[model samples]
Target chain A: PSETHRNAAEARQNTLTKPPGSLGALERIAIQLAALQETERPCADNVQIVLFAGDHGVTAQGISAFPSAVTVEMLRNFASGGAAISVLARKLDARLEVVDAGTLATSEVAGVVTDKPCHGTRDFATTPAMTPDETAFAFDTGRRAVARTVDRGAHLLIFGEMGIGNTTSAAAVAAALLGKAANDLVGAGTGLDSDGIRHKARVIDAALDLHGLKAPDVPAADVLMKVGGLEIAALAGAIVAAAQSRIPVLVDGFIVTAAALAATRLNPSCADWLIYSHRSSEQGHRLILEALDAEPLLDLKMRLGEGSGAAVALSVVRLACALHGEMATFAEAHVSESL
Target chain B: PSETHRNAAEARQNTLTKPPGSLGALERIAIQLAALQETERPCADNVQIVLFAGDHGVTAQGISAFPSAVTVEMLRNFASGGAAISVLARKLDARLEVVDAGTLATSEVAGVVTDKPCHGTRDFATTPAMTPDETAFAFDTGRRAVARTVDRGAHLLIFGEMGIGNTTSAAAVAAALLGKAANDLVGAGTGLDSDGIRHKARVIDAALDLHGLKAPDVPAADVLMKVGGLEIAALAGAIVAAAQSRIPVLVDGFIVTAAALAATRLNPSCADWLIYSHRSSEQGHRLILEALDAEPLLDLKMRLGEGSGAAVALSVVRLACALHGEMATFAEAHVSESL
Candidate 1:
């Protein structure tokens, strides 16, 4: 980010027709984008949404509400333009890329990129989710996804995921990286009752104990091998790669945020490029957000994931840039200044 | 609002591919719009923003940070597409109508409706803000403005205000209607120092006492005649007219919300059509919002009026409608539902 450009943007915001600080967060967002984009006029006119899908082996323990096969079905929905992200991508006019990171499907779904790292993970309840090679392959998958968006001239990027029991996987990864107890970080994956949630917590705790990762400063790759879903690792890799390429990443709700947590741990310098989009109603998102020191732009209580929260917030970011770049200055408007 | 349509919308929401209640406020907003529009699908595609500009005699008491001349200058700015509302209206593709509700300017400006109600209100600090006839005329202006938008097939309405010292007028009116102390309602309008705010509060308290209107259930027209700016009264009138015409009103910051409070008092039915858009940074707006039982959609700490907050939030409403109407249902997508 360019400090000189940021200072210049801040100076320009003060000259807009409104009062000094009346625009509040909108002005702050514009200045930050100006610095990150290194331009007098920042733009979010071109956005790319990358969605990675996989089946979670932990669903064998009944941690999620839906069948694991729904992961592959949602990939079909994404291709047929029926899923939430599909509708949002059209509304935002953003590029939508659906990747089958590691699903159990025998054949490819049309319009979805089929580059599987592994069919699925081993149930973390008794074994590591993936081998070290599979984890590395997932990371490469995510980096390649970022390269695709950047080469297509995407001004902004949003990472989404689809897996039936992925939230349990995300909670376990976050618990290990943040050094928090599994019970404190577990939540309803889709629509779990109190009993289901408690059971999920126990499974996570036992897995962390078996993996010996219930401590701070755990290696991100090691944690991914032990508990992270393939799509989750890919999401984290895409975040880090987008940051390295200077395309701002709008981090989504619970599942995506857990990926953001691991991404920050892997490459701390990329932290500046991630803009938290919304706080979810999920149980463990608040602690993870606090761990990342992130303040998301919206809190509509949305927890649908599939990048819906970030997609909803992208409109606000676009408006902020529009107001910053288009509104006339006080001198141009010839309006009297404050007394 | 049609209960049949609302129930149908709710039923449709449950059948969507995501988990129940995961979409949160977006789902609620869509259902409400469906009920209001009396259709299975709702929209906010055609929007009209009515910007009311006027002058306040209370500037004589040093209650505001900007010169009263700014009221007229901003009218020119709005006409020339230099004001915040002007930029936002273009971005939202909404119609922008600049109404010179009442100002001290003697001549008409191009592209502004110079329908002077009373050539601005008298100084409310030591005198009644307007005669009863002038208040009535302002309300008629607001009604006619709404009629024009309704004729233009507008699905939504937004009311904004530009008056240098109108916040003082708004605080005084809100204090009268809500039976609150003037000192509690007064805020730093435009940008005031500590000493200036204290003095403004004192003046408001004195004026409320002199009029014997520091009590609940004060007639809204009487309050307008005693302490309201012409633009404030116009905003209230527009709210009532929009509701009567079956057009949803998206209320803006402090001054507009104060107008909404008075509008609900005048015609309680209008309260059902008002959608609180964003919480402002102004002090009194929170209390007024609470009084109206409003949970605004956004809280970006924005205090810039001219309907900027509501305009920024318009896209969210549009997206909500699009999601509600376009996304594939579980049966249509052939996706499994939650167990």
Candidate 2:
């Protein structure tokens, strides 16, 4: 963090018309942005939403409500401005990039960037999801995507994922990292019923036992190869790369947070660059947020992925910047200060 | 609530791309707007923020950090577009109306309504803050202000207040309504140190004792006359009148919620027309929200209290309307539904 810029922002906050710290998270957000941007005045004018799409081999377990084909279908929905994220991206005026890291379906969508290292991962219930080399390749794909956006003058990056049954994979990854049983971290993905949740948990538990991965001891890369989906690996890569590039990352819902967990585990410094967007209504999202010690910006009980939460929260982030840059100081407004 | 329109909206929500009840508060807001507006397609396009400014005699007790004169000063700042709410009004493209309900200063500001029932409320620390007639007039001022805006095409109303030392009066009113001690409902207003908060609590406790108000029995008008500021009284009146007029009310922070509490006491049905904007970090705000059973749209810890939270939340409300009205249904999007 840039202490000088943060100090300057804090000093400016005290001089605003309202009482000191009255703006709450907005005041903190301004200071954080100042520190991240290394400037007294921070702007979030150029925002980009990078959506990573992949297919989860764990779908073979029949855990998710939707079919794996829905992953590629949603990519087309995103490109055609029919998905939730597409609507939000237009509403927020953010550039939307759909990256197909790896999907079972062939990539022929017009706007989606196809850069898969594998068609999909092996079903983790029986075997590791991805080879180590393929995991690294997915990570590099994420890094390069962020680098390209930063080169295009994007100051803020929002990461979202689209993968059927990806939440099961995220749970498996989280279970390994937190050293918890699958029952503790598993949840209904894409509107699962009670029975579906039990089935999902069993699948995750079997995957963990199959891979012999344990929390806090397994390397992040190995965990990604063993249980993570291609989109999750890419998201982790994007988060780390964004931090390395000094660009802030706005993390979406549960799946994105699992990627953040992996990113922070790989490099603790990446956590500093992450801005949690909202608390998803998905059951295990709270555990992921608690694990990261994250305070999300909103909690509207939204559980839909596709960076929708981050896109919805982008307005608050922009308003924070606007208030920081535009509101008159007490001296300028001639308003009285605290006695 | 219009059951017909609400039923229509609920049906539409189930058909949206996400799962049933997935959008959380956004879904509820859309349904509420439909019921209040009595339209199949609700719109929050014409939004107005009515900020009531007044002075409080309790400033003589040293309860607040800022002077009462700052109320009038901030009115000028609001008019000149230099305040937090002013910037937010511009950003949200909402109309801003500053009402000089009862500030001590002479109302010569160009854009302010200058409709004071009196110069200011009498200090309730010694006696009733307002006479019954004066309280009635303040309510009428609020009623007519909202009526004129509705006549001018405002579909949504946001109520905010500007008054130094008003938090003490709000606490006093809340204590009477909630059957709580003053300390339980008092907070540091505008950067008061710990000692000031204790002093403010004592003042409110004394006022509650002076009024001889017991919970669940105190009449709304009597409570307003006993402890409410002219601006808060006006806000209460506006809320009641807005509900009568079938316009949705987007309520602001602590002081505004106190007014809402009073309004709900006057007519319990008004709560149906109210939408809480955000949860204030102010100490007593949670109590007031709990009393109202309010589920605020945002929890930014904001306590600026000039309808700033309401204005900030307007974006989300607007987006909810847009998504409700614009998004393609499951059939239109050809998205698969959960089995």
Model 2: residues with Cα > 4 Å off, grouped in runs: none
* Candidate 2: clashing pairs of residues: none
TM-scores for chain B, in order?
0.98, 0.97
> In candidate 1, which residue pairs clash?
none
| lDDT (Cα, tens digit) per residue for candidate 1, span B1-339 | 999999999999898888888888899889988988898889999999999988988889988888988888889999999888898899889999999999887899899987767788899889999998899999888998998888798888999999989989999999999999887788778889889989999999999988878776789999998999899988988999999999998889999999999999999999999888899999999999999999898888898899999998898999889889988999999998887
What's the TM-score of every candidate structure? 0.98, 0.97
lDDT of predicted model 2: 0.88
Give the lowest summed-lDDT range of ten residues in model 2 chain B.
Answer: B330-339
